[model samples]
Target: MLAIETKQLSKSFWKNNVVKQIDLQVEKGEILGFLGRNGAGKSTFINMLTGILPPSSGSYALLGVQGPNNAVKKEIGVMPDYSSLYGSMTALKHLRYLSEVSGKKVSQSRAMDVLQLVGLEAHANKKAGKFSFGMKKKLAIAQAIVHDPQLIFLDEPTSGLDAESVIQIHRLIQRLHQQGKTIFMTSHNLDEVEKICSRIAIMKDGKIRRVGTMDELRAYYQSTITVTMKHAPIAATDLATLEPWLKQVGAQLEMEASHFTIQVESEQKIAEIIRALGSYKIDIYRVDVDEPSLEEIFLEE
Candidate 1:
């Protein structure tokens, strides 16, 4: 069974329907990236799925247990963007507390191991309230995984973190994946999501508008491939000479000095232009083919 399944699930606050009917599935061991703008109901959807609130309509299942099931809840970990830490408790104490609350209590040494995993070993004895925002975020992460849950939800996991902290969190996420844990994450850091997530789902105006892998989403929007070539400068006459070949490949060309940006109909159609260029001994030094960047795709979505 899938780690998560939703069928037309929705949530509303009085008159405003923040979360519209959403049908999404997260498979086992898959890192799914969920994205949306500020008011797109991403948080509301997550809140309902995590049992913080009930859906206004429809239903969902987490690890095959429908709706709010305490048994399944114990098997899932959540690192919400807005979580509070106890002012009087040390980081290690927080982890130990959660471990017990989840009914999977471990030794103090194991809690220390978790603190180390989140790069909070030095602050294990420090009060959570005295830690920096980034350090507190790390503490929250440690609490989430202290019980060794099979599925994790990370909401804006690195939002206010420093470069080093962000890198550490990314590495920790990799370890979780290696342990065969399914992760459902939401983040505005498009570059990070592009690097780590196996598949993506985009929500818009309270509904999921698109879902696919990077390449699949690229193709979903009829986006063309842009190939930038570095070669010797081309004269207008040379470009005109290549017009027939370019037309055959259905490419729109832009030239600037030694660089040529060929916007092809698609990736499959770019090969013909490259073959013709090679046949002309254009001496191609480098070729970089790019689809629209994740930010560009998100804005367009």
Candidate 2:
């Protein structure tokens, strides 16, 4: 079953469509990263799915239930880009209040556990008014998962945290995934998303532009493969003799002493080049195939 599904879901304000006909589905147990520039309608799309704003057209289902209702709300947790916290209340109380209002009241000990997971247990009694910006972010994350919801939506979960705090959050996310929870998050930290997300979705102009695993996206954007080989030195005359073989494989070779670089059309040609080099009695010390990174793929038009 899909953890979340949408069919031509859209939202608009009069003449401007903020989210334009987005058809997307997120399978269960996936840490899907949503990426887009500012004013890309990412927030609007999220708000619609969370039931904060009604859609102008189309439909969506959360955990296989149509429409937004108390039952569906109880099964999903949302940590918005900006959450309004009760400044006068302590962190512990904040979780308790939000938990109960969501129809799943957590006990005092359970509240403390959530705080600990986010590295805020020591400040359990500290009022949010006096907490640092990072601390507030932690509390917001804590409240989102206090009820142990099956699905989570974290918007910029580590936007303003220190290195140590980022690591803590990464570990917490992995632990949740181990228990089969579906995570749909949005972040500008491309490196972090590349490291932790199983799949990525790139949105633009209020529509999804690309969505796939990292390798699939790379292949779609990359036109050529680069293969670097370290081998025993060969004479310029001998290297020139291999031009016919290289041409047959649709590859171009550039050599620097014992180091050689070959640009090929596909990975299949790379294997052919390797075998051909072996026939020439060249002792290959190493071979490296360069693949495009997530950032490189995301920047493509």
Candidate 3:
């Protein structure tokens, strides 16, 4: 079954089209990383999906249930970018209350277990008002998963978190995946997305630009690549034997004497470049292809 699906989903305020015709589909057990620049209507689109705000036009379905409906809400969990907490309430209290609201009633021990899962067990009795920014973010995540919903929407789960906290949250995300949950998350950190997401969908001008795995996204933006091969230091004389062979394969040799860079546009050219190098019998040690990272692809024009 599809986890989430949308068609021409859009939102506008006072004639400002925040979200445009966005047709997106996510499969069950898929981890989709949603990407967009600031002010690109990413939040608006997420809110619409999570039922916080209604779309001005179009429609969406969550787990085969159509909306505007409340039944789907129980099947989904949402960790919004910002959440309000009662500073006076303890972390344990927050979890229990959210669980109850989600139609599940658990003992205090269960609540503490959830807190421990988020690494906040030590501060269970501490009031959320006094919690650090990272702590509150953790609490938000804990609440979202307390019910163990089938599908979860996490917006910048690592925002406001320190390096250590980021690592901890990543592990938590992995744990949820192990339980076979579908996760749709948003993040500006391409490295983080690359590490955890099964697929990615990028938004630009309030519309989905592309959606695919790392290789698919790379292929969409694939252009000339700068191949940097590191081997035993090359003398100027090495170029004579190597350059001719490269030329034969329509590959160009460039840069300093110790190394060479090949400008590759197609995958076939890259293969030919490697073939030429292998045949030359040079003392090759390493070859590095300088391709665009996920971040670069998101920012591409």
Candidate 4:
């Protein structure tokens, strides 16, 4: 069964339609990244799925159970905002309380394990009011997974974190994915999404504008393929041999002292270009293929 499935799901606030008819499916064991600009209704979409807000229309299912019902809530975890943390409660107390509140109480040992998983074990006794913003974020994650839910929703999991903390959270996320937990996460960090997510969905003005793997997204744009080759400088006379070969293939080459780059319509031309270079006795050191980045693709239109 799909981890998440939505058909024509929508939400409206007053006369303003916030989340349009969005049809999205997230396979079990997949890490799907949801990307969008500010006020893209991402939070509202998540809130509706997590049972915070009711959708204005349409339907969604989580893990084969039609929800946002109690059964589905039990099988899923939502990362809460740091502000929701009780100022008087210690980190350990927080997890234990949340676990009980979710109707899936865990032992103190398991609670500590969750704390350690988020690198907050040392501060287990520290009250939430004394925790740093990053620490609270960690606690928030710890709260999300303490009950071992099958699916998780993380909103900007690494936002406002230090470099080390960000890396820690990335590793934690990868570890969770490795454990076969389906993750539906939203982030403005395109590079992080590109590196970590299996597929991505982009939202704009309450509508899903695009959704696919990186390669699929690139193909949607029909991006130009840039091939960069690092090689020993070719003799001027060898240009006579290579230039015509490039033109014959409808490729444009820009030469430098020791490296050259070529732009082609498709990736199929790369192999032929390499063979032609080898035939011309060009000593190739390295070759790099370039495509449009997620940032570049997100910015278009």
Instruction: Pick the TM-score winner.
Output: 2
Residue 124's lDDT within candidate 3 is 97
Clashes of each: 0, 0, 1, 0
lDDT per residue, candidate 2, 175-214, as tens digits?
9999899999999899999999999999999999999999
Per-residue lDDT over 1-301 for candidate 1, one digit per residue giving the tens place of the 0 to 100 score: 6999999998989999999889999998989999999988888888898888888999999988897789898899998768989999999899988889889997899999999998999989999989998998999989889899998999889899999989999999989999999999999999999998989999999999999898888777755677888887565777788866675566667766787777777666667777877777777788898877778889999
lDDT order, best first, reads 2, 4, 1, 3
For model 3, give the 10-residue run with minimal summed lDDT.
Answer: 248-257
RMSD of 3: 2.0
In order, what is each prediction's RMSD in angstroms?
1.7, 1.4, 2.0, 1.6
What is candidate 3's CA lDDT for residue 58? 94
lDDT of 3 by residue, 184-231 (tens): 999988899999999999988898889999988887797667677776
User: Positional deviation of 287 in candidate 4, in angstroms?
Assistant: 1.6
Residue pairs in clash, model 1:
none
Model 2 TM-score relative to the real fold: 0.96
For candidate 4, report its TM-score.
Answer: 0.95
What are the runs in model 1 whose C-alpha is more than 4 Å off? 233-240
- Candidate 4 residues 1-301, lDDT tens each? 6999999999999999999998999999999999999999898899888988999999999999887679677778899443468999999999999889889999999999989988999999999999998999999989999999999999888888898988888898899999999999999899999999999999999998999999899889756788898988888899877777777775677878888788888778888888888888888999998878899889983
Q: Model 2, 85: alpha-carbon shift in Å?
A: 1.0
* Candidate with maximal lDDT: 2
Model 3 compared with the native: what TM-score? 0.93
User: Can you tell me which runs of candidate 4 are displaced by over 4 Å?
Assistant: none
TM-score of 1: 0.94
